[model samples]
Target: MKPAINPNKIVVFTGAGISVSSGLEAFRDSDLRSVGQHEQLASPHAWNRRRKEVIEYYNWRRECAGKAQPTPAHLAIARLEQKYEVVVITQNVDDLHERAGSRDVIHLHGELRKVRCCGQHALVSDIGISPQYLGDTCPDGHELRPHVVWFGEQIMHYSETGRHFKTAAKVLVIGTSLQVDPAAKLPKKGRYRAEKLIVNPHFDVADRPYSYRIIHKEADSIVPDIVAAWLEGQRWDYGLGRA
Candidate 1:
């Protein structure tokens, strides 16, 4: 179903599936060993302890994410931002959403491009291009660590994300299974005006009790169509802002 075109405030919740079109791998879709290895080696405890393994793992991720670009689906959402107050809450660690010209995106998973100090949560911009070597260090004299959330650790800035959800007029779930915590609860946490919309080809969140519209399709195929339909309803012409 098409969403109400005149939405004042729109919050889009995206996931790794959106990045898969850009040649990135999802942890659940690929071999478990690679995902687990990367997670273990990139964790705070691992980086503080087994520094070499951590650097190598994150360096690989950095290289991969660096080579990837945003998909058409990402661009479509950015276009929506022009007409509606759009705020993206994404689980993907890549900067594709930003590259697509999205203004305000909250990464539930930390970015792969940035680095932080080992002891403190403080991050540094623009750190890795190649695989990070053993001797990487922050300007503050501490070892540089990956800016990613590892297993068994609390998600950074969750309270801020919850606050964003509380203010949303509509919640759009794109390319996510909604199996993960805190993020999984965001749809239900919003006000009654909020309408949930899920778009995914694989598993979906339709079994849940939230008021939602489910579209079983790939992001690249459905997003442009969805946005096209949304735009046609407005008084503005179709090509108002083409990127």
Candidate 2:
């Protein structure tokens, strides 16, 4: 018997794992690969302590982000919106979800493609060129920095994300360990625990009672099937083909 999407408002919360297949790495795994490096480069302390290096570091990542492509998992997730009211809440800063055609996407972390002024966050702009220099500034003369949510900063969309999570009729968690705070807790703190589905190879917190549908696999390979089953009224033949 094929499983069906619980007929409810759907929110797919994605993480770094989903984007890994697209050639991006988690901060811990990147070239500046260290917990210390992440703290230094991706933290507000680091941003303030070494603004020039931080800008250089993010510029390098942005260049890589610009070249990265959306994976099959991303494409499958995008297709879900056709049959369900899907909103993608992704931890990734890349535009892969948008590129793959998902219209309603929220970046939990601030984006890698955008640069912002230190003084005015409203002064954000796309980074069309690599190596944003020290001189890059807003009209107000504040330095332009990567619009990412550093360690000391609140996530890019804090209240909006929680409100959506609280009201979501259903949530599909993909390729995340559920280790990050606040976001990790939202799965259980909703108006309705609208049938939680988790797809990931490994998660530290598998003991959570609310998560019932656990598909332990990489997303691109399995997500399409789930989405397909949901769209086709729960008719799926996993080994045979579409039923």
Candidate 3:
């Protein structure tokens, strides 16, 4: 079927829920315990006290991330790029969207497979397989840390994300409970004129009020169907003299 290429500019804001279908665990997943139980690791402060635990924690996540593959929802967005100018702004540190062939993804929460200097936000690079030990340093001898944006850190690409949203004609939000700040507030940052679409198993929008269509289902199950339906409608509309 001919893909729906919305002539309007398209953008997406995604969260960890999108990757849950591919076996990635969300921070609040019922099966997984809290960070405190997981050795109280994964923060800049924790890393400072016990760098080994922090490295080990992320190493575990890296292994899980390495094994996880992109779901159909990810591929649907990638396919959308074939017909429109697509820009993805994701809170997930996982690289699934990129792996699914989406070209322009802005990782707001940093990436799991990368490491950068703690002293300076140096260029993040791939350090495959193992944990980044204490001696792992950038060219400047500054110790490297997990490239993730922890609880208190400011998102690195905030300004760029704002700019992308400002120019977007349509914004689709998927798999997120809009409860967290900054990242949760991203979809609202876009121009008010942009058409908003929300896809989640349960829509959680208490803080902000925006008109949206809530598709109640798993992302992997619903997203491909949504994309295909939209595209097919567009094809039919164009084929008929109605568009």
Candidate lDDT scores, in order, read: 0.72, 0.74, 0.75
lDDT of 1 at 99: 91
lDDT of 1 by residue, 1-243 (tens): 323433577788898777668877644368586677865675667756887777777777778778877899999989887677888988888889999999999988788888777656575667646566676777777776677788767776677777776777666678888788866776665656665567787854445536666777788877777676555543212233222
Candidate 1 Cα errors over 4 Å, as ranges: 1-7, 26-28, 31-33, 128-131, 204-206, 233-243
User: Candidate 2 — what's its lDDT?
Assistant: 0.74
Residue 165 C-alpha lDDT in model 2: 65
TM-score of 2: 0.85
Error of 1 at 55 (Å): 0.8
Residue lDDT tens for model 3, 1-243: 322434467788898778877877644365455445344675667877888877878887888787888999999989887667889999888889999999999998889889987665576679865666767888887888898887667887888887777777677788898888777777776666556677787776454447555666788876776667455544212123223
* Candidate order, TM-score descending: 3, 2, 1
TM-scores of all candidate predictions against the true structure: 0.84, 0.85, 0.85
* 1 or 2, greater by lDDT: 2
Off by over 4 Å in 3: 1-7, 26-28, 31-34, 37-39, 205-208, 230-243
Clashes of 1: 0
